[model samples]
Target: MKKYTADENRYENMQYRRCGKSGIMLPLISLGLWHNFGDKDNFDNARTILRTAFDNGITHFDLANNYGPPYGSAEKNFEKIFKEDFKHYRDELLISTKAGWDMWPGPYGNFGSRKYLIASLDQSLQRMGLDYVDIFYHHRPDPDTPLEETMGALDQIVRDGKALYIGISQYSAKETSKAAEILREQKTPFLIHQPRYNMMDRWVEEGLLNTLEHEGIGSIVFSPLEQGILTNKYLNGIPEDSRAATEGSYLSESQITTEVVEQVQKLNDIAQSRGQSLAQMAVAWLLKDQRVTSVLVGVSKVSQLEDNIGALENLEFSQNELEEIDRILKKD
Candidate 1:
């Protein structure tokens, strides 16, 4: 096949927001490679998703070391596609990868130690065939490791030029502040955070968002659709082809209770009333909060990407609608 050429007017309809105090502005919607783009997945489909994402001005691609089912295969697969398709547009993209989870079969393979993070990123860069990543994150907070050690390692990562910016994912508000202070003292570019935030999961609203705001750090939320529960696919009960129906899926069928389904149905009705799909409404709801820099959405197909991006079209909500949504979500 011929080399992939991106759409010249990709930025025309897409909106960009400044990432906190940073000069970098990410698209309203970013692509997350947590689900697909693995060696077990179809290469052609992954190509289509990447192409469609770039065509729609999604310059940021979020990845992690343990994203693939077998782990690290997603980066290998993406390296192939990126080298063939996106090598020329390197400067135009924000590529991020994370560590701090189980990766290899050794004591040093996990957590936020300086050794683990540094070695993981080196392997990540090698797998992605990139000299450096835009952002490298400590996938999660390490309860055992000293915060200074992790932050110092991140500071070192920036100084080493292995990554341009450093971030921490799944950290508590207190932890975020502590890490931010350490990174600030070290003069590291503590750019953004990756947290699982959605209409279903509002934990970030407690204090994480505020901490990020006060510290001038950006936030990119993942699982914006709550693993497809926010979409219309669950309105009539889980389809056999859905994620909930798959064995050993994170979103198990048991999680889809009757009451949860009822709430989603009501939310879907509200979305329809606003001329948007349930998934679109969910994405828009997150972006309506000024603290959110971008909503990280993972999709299996190109059509899903289009529908998710459509959330940017109508992000405004009236007071009544906000109250109604709050009422519906707060229900037991």
Candidate 2:
């Protein structure tokens, strides 16, 4: 409850990348409020995490309407933390939030309809107590709704001054090209794409990264740690209190087979050789590619956040290391 002042040398050690061809520059590591910023979590810890992120020059904070367990709690909690610590530094920060997933119960509460997208941003803005978010994203592709309607709503949001720029998440390469075309026709600033990319999951490599590069749209990847599987936490086995141990979590025990543990152990050995934690190595591996504008990282503790930030120390990989990583991942 004391005052907060950001570090004077915050930007000295952190790295920034231009988001696609945009005028905005995002930190190499951005903080995500997907899990630990909810109402059920510790408020003081969450506040400390936010402060730690900002103090370390992490200017971009990503959130979604349905991020919290009860939905909308993350934004509400962020509002309190922002009002206390970050209100004065708003200009120095780039805050983003998304819609397009299941937010509310009714027909208008979900999907890509203009009504849903527009209303969702209003609620998100209200929850976060902000006049406008730096960037707003459609959380996913709504299979039932037309893509034009969804992209059109995003265009409208920018026109209405509700959001500065628009983005999309989890869209395929073809779909991304189409959406980019629609936004381009309208001259809307479709700035970034939020995809799930990591050492474990390479779906974006199929065509999505190339598509983003061709279309001149940036990407900030989520789940770069593969729901914590890419880290050393699972090298031995799933801990009793780990996400894999919890029922109904996104990562389950079944996903962590003996083979997966072997792979993680091999990865951990490689990480130790590089003088980095497994989590740090996993994150640095993603940044090795220039197309990755930023890597979205989520953490429960401030130390974890700092560890992720430490990935900036070594973002390079030799051909041998790259080949070894490919061999490890491609092994049956």
Candidate 3:
């Protein structure tokens, strides 16, 4: 395997923000392997994307146990790239994986039970070729399992050195507050919260952000582009090679209605006025709020990563621009 040497000035332009009240600092833009880092994906393209992201100062890489089509293939593939390129720089990276979703067939393989969380992390660490992950998340709330049991598993993982910090994803404000209290009682480092937040999806602002702020939990928002809807790819109708047309993709063609295209076109005008792409403006809008620790972005190509990262160059928004956006999005 050829060794990879990262850019010596990789940190030059990358802005790092404190994760809530924690000592850790994450890049304004983090890479998520939720889309193309799988067995069915091209390994070389995936490797390039990872390399470009890291070179551009994206130190945090997010993954989940059930991310791939076959479940866990993303971790397995990432392990190969990590060992070949990043093993020597482990301390410089923050890798996270979740396990709350369904991962296997047996009753013990899914949910937030102590057995499932523990076993899942063990398997995750093995697949990633790491003794510990920077963060471990309960992918989603499991109403079937006791919150105590699920949180207890996270506390145990930190204590056993299997994970450095604990986080929760797709959790409601009420559920987040409850989980934070439990983790606090255990004295675990409940570092961050991963929520699906974007220009189109403003659910996080509906009290989830307040909850995280109250608990001193940092937030890394996923889908800042709203599954490509906030980008130019959908402006001229979904392309045959686009995610909306791809089978099994979370973004379906039916979801891209004519109204959505019109909205996107109007939003693109705002982006062009700001001298940025629609995607760049979308990511920049999220960063305007200090509560957002980082905006998680997924890209299939290195060019996409570079284009998205350009949002950092100009994050400022005039008062009129903000109001105009609201007017467009809220105009039914």
Candidate 4:
């Protein structure tokens, strides 16, 4: 193990909240290695962001087996850092990784089959330079694979001490209920469910929120800023360095139409009334539901992270403000 030291004192401003009924307490804001921190990007900059996140109370760093431009590069980069400045601070961190998406070229490289699931986690563990990850997630649902096989693999992971908990991402309410029932029967803790939720996207409000609340499972919504569309960066037009002009598979030109811009402007008016930017207000909005344990945020630079971290300064949203926002964005 490499020698390192973390400022155990910063735990003061850093708030850790319980994940629903589970005893696991995660930091209010978690950093995600979804776009940056890959071999295709600058390693030094990634290191800076990771350290900055740690310095600013972000203890959880989320990654997956296939988060990079060329799959597995994100985990490989994280493993390199874990072997360097992060080995000794391992106990102080909540590093989570996932599988179940398309990884390698072969059939065994993807999905939730026991063969694929277990093997993918093995690769993740090896790439992260750890015997186990605190949270292991199934990236998406598998329609063909039996839920029992997936649950069994998760059970084996905990039984063998390879993962402390198992989570599901982008799962529908039906699948979530089914998985929760089986896991509860086997005395397994379904820790968290990650979903793409934001002011622009209110799909989860239909039923997913009630499902998680009823089942007592935790939720950490991603894309809460809608890939930075809520920010003032696009008020005029797409800047050259924005995610739109970059290699973004999620945020593209087709998404930024006159209608989206108008809705964003109307929402911005509401955010300004609250004395917050649209991005900050959006982040604050997600935390309005106490059921949401954390908001997984992605950034391209330290300044972006700093601005995002400032969202904690103001989290309150009044009923009228929410109603006005709903009028404009609920249908968008």
Candidate 5:
């Protein structure tokens, strides 16, 4: 492609929020590479998505070691894109990657052992062609490993200069408190948490948000659209190419029940009344709460990314609107 130049006025429209009590200020909407950006996907589109995100002032880009269809491909692909387009603008970006899922074959390649966490980030750094990532997350809670061991590994990574900040993903409210305690004792810069929080998934609201606030840890929530269920893509029915129609996808067809479609339709009405798309409203709903530091949005197209960014236009909700949403969500 031709030479890329980021918009000079990118920061003017996008809203930035303080990440808990940290010096870091994250965009209200962050880009995620959970879907697309793999080896099998379009490379040019992926490059454009990254460019568009930065052009729109989305500084934070979230990725994981196992993000691609074949593990490690996303990082490798990102390395190429970064060199081609963002090499000079590296300081202007906030790049994050996680490791804690089934990455490779063997006992030492997975989980929260110091050996695994340390080795995994080393490999991730190598693949991404970076000395250090802006943030490195543990990806998930390891029930078998001790919390101290996991948090200690994170602390070591920061002290080793592998990652500037440490984060954890999908950890329960209780587990998050324990992890934060350990990191505090270690004096690590435990900056953030990544959780699956959306209108449909309210698990974070139970206590996780409270824990993050109390611990002074920011949260960048994933699956904010509930794997596309919160969007209008399935309002009529599951499209032939939708994630739900594809076998082995995280969102199964059965999960999109009649009740869900009904809920989405009602929710869509509210979105229209608010002059936003369902996807936009879904993101706004999360941003309505100050506890959520940022919303991690994964998109297949550049237009979707722009639409999500449009959520910054109207982040407010009337008291009646909030109760209506609660009532609709509570319906059977």
Candidate 6:
């Protein structure tokens, strides 16, 4: 790739955060290709969203091997943008990709084993047109493979200069602590963890957050709006374009219960008082904690991404407001 300097004036104001104890810095708002950048979607729209995101200082792009509808399409689409508008900004960007999910059939194809992780990452780089990923992840834990083996492969990826750092997503606190020890020995550190957490779904509060903090590993949460449940979009009914209406795997009709809608309404009022949308409020809430390096958000449009970028303007949360919001949530 050759140098094509982006309009630096466009993104000079967004916040940049450090990844835990590592020297690497990630933008406070990162973009995740888990949705929107799919094979079945419009490529031009996807490219616009990607460029708009980068123009707003979203330097980190999160991708996975099986991200697109037919699989690997997201990486391929990203490759197009990389070869075009983003070629020069490669050094300024922090691109990441993950494996550990179903990519191919047979035993060697998927899992947390050394063979699977290594092979999957190499293929991911080819798809994305990159020499190496800034951070490579085990998309999810492979229950069958030993944690030691998975950690070893991740260490080797760093040692081989195939990845700048390593991370695990959705692993338990116990599992994270266990892996931390193994990586420490090789001097290969895990940079971050991705978990599904939002105001509605606070599973990480159970233990994952503390574990990462204790181990000095940063975390970036996904589905911070609980697949848009925390927003007012579902309060009346599922819109035709909603994730639930589209039968998204992560969201379902049953998720939008009457009680859930009522809770979101209450939260919406709180956001109104704070002068922000439910989405912006939700994102700000996540960045309030220092242990969280960024919130990897997904969007379908450049305007939508622009609206989300607005959250950086109002990240402070008063203790009383947080307590009041928690009080409402505790009842459910």
| Residue-wise C-alpha lDDT for candidate 6, range 172-192, written one tens digit per residue | 999889989999988996899
Please give each candidate's TM-score: 0.99, 0.99, 0.98, 0.95, 0.99, 0.96
Q: Per-residue lDDT for 231-294 in model 5, tens only?
A: 9999987899999999889989999998899999999999999999999999999999998989
Candidate 6, poorest ten consecutive residues by summed lDDT? 1-10
Each prediction's whole-model lDDT (CA): 0.94, 0.94, 0.93, 0.86, 0.93, 0.87
lDDT (tens digit, per residue) of candidate 4 on 284-306: 89988888899999987898887
* Alpha-carbon deviation at 66 in model 4, angstroms: 0.1
Relative to the true structure, candidate 5 reaches a TM of: 0.99
lDDT of 4 at 249: 61
Tens-digit lDDT string for candidate 2 (1-332): 78998889889988999999999899999999999999899999999999999889999999999988779999999999999999999999999999988898989998799999999999999999999999999998999999989999999999999999999999999999999999999999999999999998999999999999999999999998999998878989989999999987899999999989998999999999999999999999999998999999999989899999999899989899999988988955
Tens digits of per-residue lDDT, candidate 1, 1-332, equal: 66799999999999999998998899999999998788888889988999999999999998999888779989988999999999999999999999999999889999989999999999999999999999999999899999999999999999999999988899999999999989888889999999999998999989999999999999999999999999999998989999999987889999899988999999999999999999999999999998999999999999999999999999999999889989998955
Window of ten residues with lowest summed lDDT in model 2: 323-332
Runs with alpha carbons beyond 4 Å of true place in candidate 1: none
Q: What is the lDDT of residue 284 in candidate 4?
A: 88
Ranking of all candidate structures by their lDDT, best first: 2, 1, 3, 5, 6, 4
Candidate 5, which segments miss by more than 4 Å at Cα?
none
Q: Assess the local accuracy of residue 30 in candidate 2 as a C-alpha lDDT between 0 and 100.
A: 99
* Model 3 lDDT per residue over 1-332, tens place: 25679999999999989999999999999999998998989998999899889898999999999887579999999999999999988999999999988899989988899999999999999999999999999999998899999999999999999999999999999999999999989999999999999888899889999988889999999989988999999999999998899897889999899989999999999999999999999999999999999999999888899999999999999999999999888944
- Cα lDDT over the full model 2: 0.94
Give candidate 4's TM-score. Answer: 0.95
- Assess the local accuracy of residue 177 in candidate 5 as a C-alpha lDDT between 0 and 100: 92
Instruction: Name the better of 2 and 3 by lDDT.
Output: 2
